[model samples]
Target: MTELDLATKAPESDAQEDSSVDSPTQSSPIMGDHEHCVTDRPAPAGQGPTGEIIKLNDIDVYISKPADYPHAPTRLLLFLTGGTGIKSVNNQIQADKYAAEGFLVLMPDMFGGETAPGGKEAYVADNSVSLLEQVKLKAVEIAKSFLIDMWLARVTEAKIMPILHKVIEAAHEEYSDAIKHGEGIYAVGYCVGGRYVLLLAKGTQEGGNDEESGMMKAGPFIKAGALAHAASVTPDDFKNLQAPLSLVCVENDALFTDEVRKVGEDLMTQDNVEHEVQVYPGVPHGFAVAGQYQESNIMDAQVTAYEQMLRWLKDH
Candidate 1:
């Protein structure tokens, strides 16, 4: 079905609670050691003193690129951070995992800073605001508020798209492309980053034009996107997605639950699109983050996820 036709589906009850009833910090241990696969790497490619900056709305946007490699794959993992933002403790671990797997990683700071206000205390805060206020202002707003969507437009504006355009352009400008396909880019996004990746796959630079055109014309910068524990974009937004897509939902993920599943399911029926949904048993939200640094089913899930993504990227 056409995307416009697909977009007409009514939005769901924003009233549904996505928070985990059972705490992840309190989960009992499982068999295998799942500590972070990556250690000693810098936090993402930027967020440091001397990383490259791409200015979007004059907001000193940071874009991290892995150091020069003779045989770098064309794939790019554009990470979108969760509540903790880009400097999150989980990022280093995931970046290391993707880099080790041979994908050139780019962790973009969608949020201006790291960590959200009130921390996890909001979960148990009783003297706090009403449930609707808590969910709207804190939960949904923190993830994909109206402003963030507005920011997407700015990224696509004449001045901003060029910056992001240059970032992707420069990557291919210097890579070998000897592995997998000669010229194809793949993406994996976690949490907020997961939703960001779909926006990326649908098209780029907010309006779904400029950056996508430039990147695609530049040398096949993106072919497919995979979202893990994505809680940002609603199913209605799935209409924007065009490239091959994969949705990963953790059994213990507090963010994107069964309601999120219905959205992904609806998108699966679209033509010329390859979509798959995988729910990892007992895995938590930010499972990739946890898997990279601790013991859990996380690593297996990530490996399986990436393998599926690569297979799709190559075939599509």
Candidate 2:
């Protein structure tokens, strides 16, 4: 199949863990979008997570603090997950990496407990299935959750933003003094998670979407935000951006298409917000985290996106 074949379906966020290993993979699924190509195979191993999952107001948060720095972190970062949610050990591992760099990272479980059915796999260079064969596979898998799109649709800014606000409010309060010494709060999101990062940038000083969306105005959380391969972004989402943003886009994506991306960037420019947009050619959606499970080229691009995103948060 062609390189883009894997992402031709729904947003590819169905990554699963090697359940046989002793980890949180066996736990019940929760909230998140299926915006990445997923497979049944166990993904690449990350350095074992150094932080424990702590329950905070019904949300399971993976908190990682700086190593030797006793003062505030370099930045208090809220790591919004891809569709994989906190179930993605890789997301936790990524957070730990940020913590090692002297950033306090908070990765919360937005997915209460709900994983996607898996029949497809990552976009590995080794896969040689014919187009016909892959299509047939997707058809059968679609039967598993014909409402997959509807299910994904439920994770809207209105529905999930409050949960995010709760997470940030509680984490910020807990890390009060140390956070004050830091560079304030920043965020990075992957896949559908990217959409929320943008919303965080656009949110009110009370935090979350407009009160017209029926959410109570919560405390402010995000200072700046970054996202990669964002999915489900509407032009209206960009109309009132309030924070700095960095976007690492891929060349090909069905959801975060060029037109939509242009609209968002143009709006950001019109709003005179601090932002940066770069599209890495030849990669598809979900390359930031999901690509690490694919071919070496994909993985390399993913690594570059990581470094650029980190720099954006620290220096911006």
Candidate 3:
């Protein structure tokens, strides 16, 4: 892990919360609404992408294709959202931008159309606490009660693997004539989504080597992956990863600290896995998807990180 050593500033305390903790639930039609599940036009700009919503194995996946798509995309991107789950405004913006650049982007609702009971308002209810305090509390609650105990339990490999298979099947069906035979399918994820990327790359639904046995596998389709400000990932998690990986770390991120970065790098190197770790200065966690509220430096960092991902995808 070579360090670039770019000048950095302390992260500012912006009012915004990481999407992983506090995002509004999207109003997209749920599964079984066959007619409304797929649409040609997306929601308003800044809200969602200008693409169609398709149901994959009963999951409502928002798919944004290039305007001239079916001409075959250079690559297919499975863009996973942060803790805020799918339908995060920032995630939508990122997906739309990538689609405009000719990549087919798919965003699945990680929460299966469910959201925090009170949504964004729940985070702000206790005015006695600072915004940061609220975010921290909400993050812990979601991680323990929802993410680990509920969501992941229901959306296991049995459910998710088929969705991945179906999405790829649909892509091939639509662009059969134009697809380049050896072109790749790539994945990029932020925060909790990043953790999922690693799981997919390793062909298992859960982390750790022992737990992977008999898990429904789905890694073969993914050629490469990039993780940005990932959470809950341990060095051991990378030992069995099959695809080349890129780690986009933020200098001031509380979750992805220097120690965690080193552990990941050391493990990847020892395992002889191809990997790259780049640290962006002056940014907080979730900068890749939600840096719009930060200063110019943070915004610039966000663009630079995104460009790095594009380059990595092209090179790999």
- Report lDDT per candidate: 0.45, 0.63, 0.57
Q: List, residue by residue over 233-283, the lDDT tens digit for candidate 3.
A: 555556577788887876755555566667667766776778888988766
Question: Which digits, one per residue and each the tens of the lDDT, describe model 2 over residues 1-316?
Answer: 0111112124435242221111222222111224243432244564567787887656788888787655433567888876666766666777787888778788887666554444344222113555454445445445534556655766655667767767766766687655576646788887667777877776453334543333356423577888877766677767678888888877756656767777777777888988887778776466676324545776788789889898988875
TM-score for each candidate, following the candidate numbering: 0.56, 0.78, 0.69
The alpha-carbon deviation from the true structure for residue 234 of candidate 1, after best TM-score superposition, in angstroms, is: 1.0
Residue 78 in candidate 2 has what lDDT? 85
What is the Å distance of residue 13 in model 3 from its true position?
Answer: 15
How does candidate 1 fare on TM-score? 0.56
Candidate 1 residue-wise lDDT, 138-250, digit = tens: 44333433433344333222342343454445545433352234355566665545655665566433432454435542222457766666654567556645677766666
Q: What is the lDDT for 70 in model 3?
A: 68
- How much does candidate 2 score in TM-score? 0.78
Q: When superposed on Cα atoms, how far off is each prediction in RMSD? A: 9.6, 8.1, 9.8
State residue 100's C-alpha deviation in candidate 3, in Å.
1.6
Best by TM-score: 2
* Off by more than 4 A, model 1: 1-68, 71-74, 118-166, 169-182, 203-221, 252-254, 290-316
Better of 1 and 2 by TM-score: 2
